[model samples]
Target: MEPASHGLRESATFDRATIHAIQRAAETGIYDIRGWGAKRRLPHFDDLLLLGASMSRYPLEGYRERCDTDVVLGTRHAKHPLRLSTPVTIAGMSFGALSAQAKEALGRGASEAGTSTTTGDGGMTPEERGHSKHLVYQYLPSRYGMNPDDLRAADAIEVVLGQGAKPGGGGMLLGQKITERVAGMRTLPVGIDQRSACRHPDWTGPDDLAIKILELREITDWEKPIYVKVGATRTYYDVKLAVHAGADVVVVDGMQGGTAATQDVFIEHVGIPTLAALPQAVRALQELGVHREVQLIVSGGIRGGADMAKALALGADAVAIGTAALIALGDNHPKYDAEYRRLGSAAGYFDDYQDGRDPAGISTQDEELAARLDPVDAGRRLANFLRVMTMEAQTLARACGKAHLLHLEPEDLVALTIESAAMARVPLAGTNWIPGAGL
Candidate 1:
């Protein structure tokens, strides 16, 4: 007899109490960070602490400091300027992963907050394009739902080299969520696992990609701003090549960014983190003498104001958010905790985004499930969150004595932890600091 199965040790090493802890059980589902694991918790903007102005430095006021967050992304060459009131933007997430209502909500919020929202793996939808004031059309490797009309409709175009979630691998539209609509849009069979091509079907390398970008610009009459987005691998080289290839902007997504649906192994195993990639991308752009000329948008794990400020100070022209926006739109609400557990997962822990069974209704395509979410309410909440993030970012910029948020520099920062120092490129607090170049 097995010594009468004493407490939480149903899984050995873990005691019965540990097994009973809902948070512990949900570890595999959520709260797991890429690269780091159960051991290291990501410090929020509130955590890891802040060091205010001292004898050496002077502080600025919350209200008195001039915090100009205005950004003109593609004014150098484009016929139209990609002007934004805030430095925060929205990352691309799929139509299949989210209902049409959700996409519309993102557009409404981003537009209201003076930022841009991206189209996803699926092609441009009329709702998204119509609602978004500054819409970006994503030319993905998969090319799902892509057409000439969308290319014309977009304010900007992003040629996707890779996504941070599964850098080299293509994505799968699982059988469960592959409805007739999604199937027809992708030109694939229904109720089957649809695999998107990993590499682009047409061109192979940088030289060929340059021609392709030109072809697109010509096709669009050189009116739209063309961007190139790549996962954070070989970023220094990729950023240089993307600029050479004639990108007006470069969107670099880091490993911690969320995906609509991807393999668990892929989500956890691949790519460099955002903290490691931002500096290299900036260094590359600086080397090319186009650091701010060709804008750089950094995505992945951008939660609050400090992250936005830190990313900008390190060289990102703008920051994009995905998971955090979903949270603002009522994801993981305790109101659905009972229903979430009924699905064998709790609200905060549920990340099975593939099956279209989300209780919060943010990530599902089912009629009843999608209806659970009201787009108007969700959009308002997201707009409010965007406002708060912008406000906080401005506050921090002011505190650092910077006239504008774009004026924030590494000199204004001091890292509380070793990781923060390396990631933020700031000196350690209370000491003479050194920086590491990850090679």
Candidate 2:
């Protein structure tokens, strides 16, 4: 017989973490608020594998063949669309949530990579704007730090309807992170927790959104591309609606997307996975006869070149990265392991970004900690990472006999799992069956 201790195992349904969370909630009388995205395992790009060229198709010579990775976004209605050398763009990280130095590093890196970086919730920063060659200004519900002059200054405008981390939910920046500068920019009281509005104050639905987009276009002189960003839920319908609203580009963010701070329940339970959302958004665009015309940018859980290739193969025009970008900028670095442990978290496991005590200095506003990160050095690291990701994506594209990354199709992929096959709309490996294709 097994030992009594061995026989008394933890319940998989009510695990240790779950039990602790329940206890914590009961004691605090409040839901847990944390940074980052869902930690639960979900079907992602990892479950899909690229089908390299063989007898049916010829392969491109890696040394000789040229695989174009360049992508142009927002050409549908904007006078000046972004012509990027690479398809990987940096997702938004707000000024309040990140140090100015970190924002500068992001700008430097994106500019070096010949891509764009976005201005998140708290509005544009001079450091970011100065360093970034192409900047996308995010217009959120809070209208924090909003100014018409800055709108005109930006290369593009992104109307954020939702985020992948907590769709249909507002964001929160704990009082600890709300410094005087942050308070001034957001027009909120210092040392007080702030919550962003879930919905746009002026817009109710698609009709109202259309007017808002028009207003933005008029404000920006139609020179900037207007991107409508929505969290991955009812993505097919949302994509269609965004297009109908005269958006030049549509950004669909998946559940794996990160956030500054939000309730753990909302982050884990609210949105759809990126893999599942991509196909729906693509289908909507195809059905509307604007698959490539409207330009689709997918975000959330995009880590490397393989992920980017998989997204493109599934019909995304480009990819956006957030958490991964922060890592490149020196977040969770092993060198900060001791500091992280002191904060009651370990390096690579730290998600308390809302605490404003990041040892890496990328996510906090503490002057001394922020100074620890050298923007130039961090920017170089990010640029290098971006370059590597682009190269890997190009290599995969070439392997699939594609002359351009954009030419990758669903046929170039095979799923390792039935769930992935169903979600990605790709066939299972060694089989012609797609689990839900018939339905």
Off by over 4 Å in 2: 1-7
Weakest lDDT window of 10 consecutive positions for candidate 1? 32-41
Residues 127-159, candidate 1, lDDT per residue (tens digit)? 788889998888988999999888988888889
Instruction: State TM-scores per candidate.
Output: 0.88, 0.98
Badly placed stretches (over 4 Å) of model 1 are 1-51, 54-58, 435-439
RMSD of each: 4.7, 1.6
Alpha-carbon local distance difference test for all models: 0.79, 0.94
> How would you encode candidate 2's per-residue C-alpha lDDT over 1-439 as one tens digit per residue?
5555678777899998999999998999988877888999999999999999999998898968999999999999999999999999999889989999999999999999999999999999999999999999999999999999999999999999999999999878889889999999999999999898999999899999999999999888899999999999999999999999999999999999999888899999999999999999999999999999999999999999999999999999999999999999999999999999999899989998889999999889889999999999999999999999999999999999999999999999999999999999999999999998979
* Model 2 poorest 10 in a row by lDDT: 1-10
